[model samples]
Target: MINGAHVIIYSQDAEADRAFLRDVLGYPHVDAGHGWLIFKLPPAEVAVHPAEGSGSHELFLMCDDLAETIADLESRGVEFPDPPEEARWGILTTIRLPGGGDLGLYQPHHEPAYDL
Candidate 1:
């Protein structure tokens, strides 16, 4: 049987990134060993997208309202690379990570299958 998911975020500044997940985003975590932090994420779902070239899997945070979510995160000092773009699936945007990367965020327009 399947269980919970574990996500690994690679960061240029791993400590700062860990701090962001722990302090900024307020995700509960435990120091496994030697200051290594492991975070617990909220409920999640996965999708498979066809790769046109050399690609990889990704992690995205979904919200009910993109604008409101963006505003709240901005107040917490988070930055976005650009405005949200609308697509058939949702309104999508990139959230700047603490170290030197970005994470995907979206407000889905389709009926959620989270209850499944």
Candidate 2:
């Protein structure tokens, strides 16, 4: 039986990124030996969308209110590369990670399946 998912974010500056997640985002985690920290995510859901090619995946952190969430994150020194924009499914924005990568953050207009 399936149990859980482990998500990996490849980083150019891993230590800095780890500190960002730990100190700024405040995601609970355990030290998995040798200073490797594994974060515990909120409830998750998976979806499949048609594409012309394969071997690609995305990660998005969802929130109940995008405006409020953005404000909170900004106060914590999080940077958004762009403002939130509307989509058929949600209002989306990109969070700039300390590792120089972007993570998606969105407030969904469609019902989420994480609770199901």
Candidate 3:
């Protein structure tokens, strides 16, 4: 029975990346020092390695507005691969995370939280 887990981002630019996550996206985080910064991420419905420029799993965050989320992320200096695209499953978008990880932002087709 698993309760909680933390996703770690290994970044070459640790401090700047941490600041980006905290200031731009407004995610709460704690600096542990020694090349590690911990971000208080939301509950995980899915998991993946977000490392950019490497063969890694994709990370997606379910958001309210696909366009707004994209815009906000862009404004905060997050690089998106492309514009939002709607698919049968959800609205898929992309962003470059602090640890050179690729972030996929999506809004699911069904309201899982509401249903459960």
> Among these predicted structures, which one has the highest lDDT?
2
Best model per TM-score: 2
Pairs in steric clash, model 3: 50-101, 50-102, 51-101, 52-100, 52-101
lDDT of 2 by residue, 1-116 (tens): 97899999999998988989889988999999988999988778888888886668999999999999999999999999999999999999999999999999999998889876
What tens digits encode model 1's per-residue C-alpha lDDT throughout 6-116? Answer: 888899999988998898889999999999999988778888888989879898888999999999999999999979999999999999998988999999898777757
- Quote each prediction's TM-score: 0.93, 0.96, 0.72
lDDT of each: 0.90, 0.92, 0.73
What is the RMSD of candidate 3? 4.9
lDDT of 3 by residue, 26-54 (tens): 88767787846678886666535456686
After superposition, the stretches of candidate 2 with alpha carbons farther than 4 Å from their true spots are: none
The global Cα lDDT (0 to 1) of model 2 is 0.92
- Could you tell which candidate, 1 or 3, scores higher by TM-score? 1
Clashing pairs in 1: none
Candidate 2 vs candidate 3: which has greater lDDT? 2
